[model samples]
Target: MTTSPAPAAPAGPDLTDEQWTTLVRARATDPQAVAKAYAARTRPAPLLSQKDTLFLVAADHPARGALRSGPDPMAMADRRSLLARMVTALDNPEVDGVLGTPDVIEELLLLGALEGKVVIGSMNRGGLDGATWTMDDRFTGYDAASIATNGLEGGKMLLRIDDRDAATAGTIEACADAVTELATHGLMAMVEPLPYHREDDGSLTLLKDTPSLARAVTIASGLGTTSAYTWLKMPSCDDPETVFGATTLPCVVLGGVPSPDPAQDLDSWGRALVQATVRGLVVGRALLYPPDGDVASAVEAAAVVLRAAHAGEDAA
Candidate 1:
């Protein structure tokens, strides 16, 4: 497939080196700066608008050791560069919020880039990419109490169910516990449940078929004591309407690994957003590190998709 021409790199953050040095110094001197920043930060008025569509930039992949974006394996390995791209993506007015692990979220908080944004904490990341125990995702990150105490909007967890893998049961139980806990705190519990099959080599492969996705959705929606505050972060499937028909809970489509063709990837997301239950998008590498390497343009393109979806809804 012919790739689109790479756009010129947009101007990065000004004085980023100096600012990073200062941030490092502060982290070294006072570990309390993260809490202070969170306390002092201004939050968005409402988590979702009247249309109920949210376009969130996700930065939680690195926590799972999945940092490859498009070609470069270590593309997101650079802390400073990743933050610079994230800040650029968040600079867009149409962008709603961010979903990240504690470290990335706290760094953005310190950089003051998360002000007036809906912040969602990543809960499970123990299933390191390519690890033998990859199916055993654990809740090693932010919990309900910490997310609420930090003034975050919600917590997200990954639940990969592989019937062949006994470890999957533990992940499900842990995620259910997290969901109940977050709901008790009146915070959103965004669960990403994907069905998988364990190969003979013990490696896991996600089953992207419609039936698999629907089954996973059914299982995830029923997790926790209550489904009131539960939301789903799902992939843009070929038949989203059928897959999403399994649950009434609100969902945000995730931008999985970057597609070689960026336009085709955006088109898929746009189509999924046409489903009423699909509230918005939670994209990461695709928007932050596009094949064109233009974070701003990639973000703008995603915003355009959401806007068009909203316009269609209003016309109906």
Candidate 2:
């Protein structure tokens, strides 16, 4: 299959030679806007299409402390190392694109890795790493306006609803507003839905239970004013079918922390990705920071599973 040609920079208005030189210097302050404006001034080039592009490599693992597919916990802790590894994986031929937090996104932009790439921005960050406020899940990165100004392709937000947590209410309202803003910009808003459940001790937990997941799905689908750009990052529930039934939006079964058995873990994900509603898989640790050293092969293997499932459905 042929990859889509990258979008040509739009042409900008004519400027004198000295004016052009000054514009290049100003780009450091506002890269996104500068790039778009300059593109507008240039003649259109070969357009890159997004046809048959399905799987999105989720790079949001460091925030969750889920850095390895096996036993290591802090594998993704080193910012520079993780960025280098991600740049390597994303540059591979088979790896389609990436799903990452704003920090990673900005890094990718600076390293010149995002040109002609499918860049998905992460929306939540206030819920810090391994914190009690995980349930609150605030939208701290890549607002619609920022994404537009930066000339990004799409954005993603987390919606883990823990009714017991008061902050969930605020996140919900903020997400709704964000959805509207992102849609107006024609950017994708992939919403990950994990309904929160308080355990007997009162600590917050993600609900894999059927009823709770169904409710979360209902609420998630109903969010924002428009559903055009909305997508679902659903948990692979105990009863996978139930989670799959939770939403009509194109869904992706997230690769949660790896299980004790790696092969079994892959098999589980493979089966889940076959569900009709599950469009693709957004996995991080399992693919990038695998226990084994083959990062490129690991990513390609996961992509094979997703692409096979997606292609089979298309053929049918």
Candidate 3:
């Protein structure tokens, strides 16, 4: 949003002059173009491109006030730079799809970056970053109906449980209702259940330990009337086997905090992908704003890891 000098974002896939003009024009005039674009866009079939695995780029963070990537506090504050990196990631042939909120997705739709890609709408982003009531991640984005009506393959909701917070209960309930609603439309309900512990000082921390993660997985696995159309979006951890052993639902590992070592991060994902239920990666900043500022290269590396994991699975 700012025009000031900020940290460099990933390079290439920059928007053309025409592309920028088209989006600006649409925003100023043609409001109905978004719906028309969705109706006419080619949809993906069989969802999973690699039979069992997928690799999806994610850009829904900005909506939730999560604009930081690495050391830069406002690294994702510039819409053009952020969207350009997203375009770069989606340009990779091996990338299966993308996950985003309405505004970002609408822009990409107008830019023609989402056609034939698996589009997942982010549902809850009401919990602002560092807010006191952050645990109340109310549904403020795409609801189940809107996601289906817009032709998205699924809807995603973030469920962070801080045991001490009462608001966590409402978030859990809302996510359950959303899962049921999405199931009625034959759409995927991708629930990201994260365990958090509110410190005495009021700071929150993600509990990525094996037991904490496994507990969160089981709790998410039972939402709604049925688990038939549900999938878990979980974080990868050491001893992934034990961490993910509690769920039979298909799972995808999300790229959480960006690490300085890309190869080390890939190795962590590769280990998680070994689990039969772990299908693929749904990564954002770790790929979009890599340390080297190469979006395509980061995406390609993720794809390679995904392919290798499935190949190893088949061989075994």
Top lDDT model? 3
TM-scores for all candidates: the values are 0.94, 0.79, 0.96
Model 1 worst lDDT run, 10 consecutive residues: 6-15
Writing each residue's lDDT as its tens digit, candidate 1 over 1-316 gives: 9986643333343326777998788889989998899899898888896677888999999999997776677777878888988899989988988999999998888888998999999999999998887777988889999998989999999999999977788999999999999999999999999999888977667898999999999999999999999999899989988998888999999999878888998899988888878899999988888776778888999999888977977777
What lDDT is reached at residue 90 by model 3? 85
- Considering every candidate listed, which one attains the maximal TM-score? 3
The lDDT of each candidate is: 0.88, 0.67, 0.90
- Name the lDDT value of residue 34 in candidate 2: 41
Write candidate 2's Cα lDDT for 38-153 as tens digits.
23332112111232435656777565544443544446665555665676677665555678876666555555555566667787767765576666677777788887776666
Provide the global lDDT of candidate 2 against the true structure. Answer: 0.67
- Residue pairs of candidate 3 with colliding backbone atoms: 1-77
Off by over 4 Å in 3: 1-13
Which of candidates 1 and 3 reaches a greater lDDT? Answer: 3
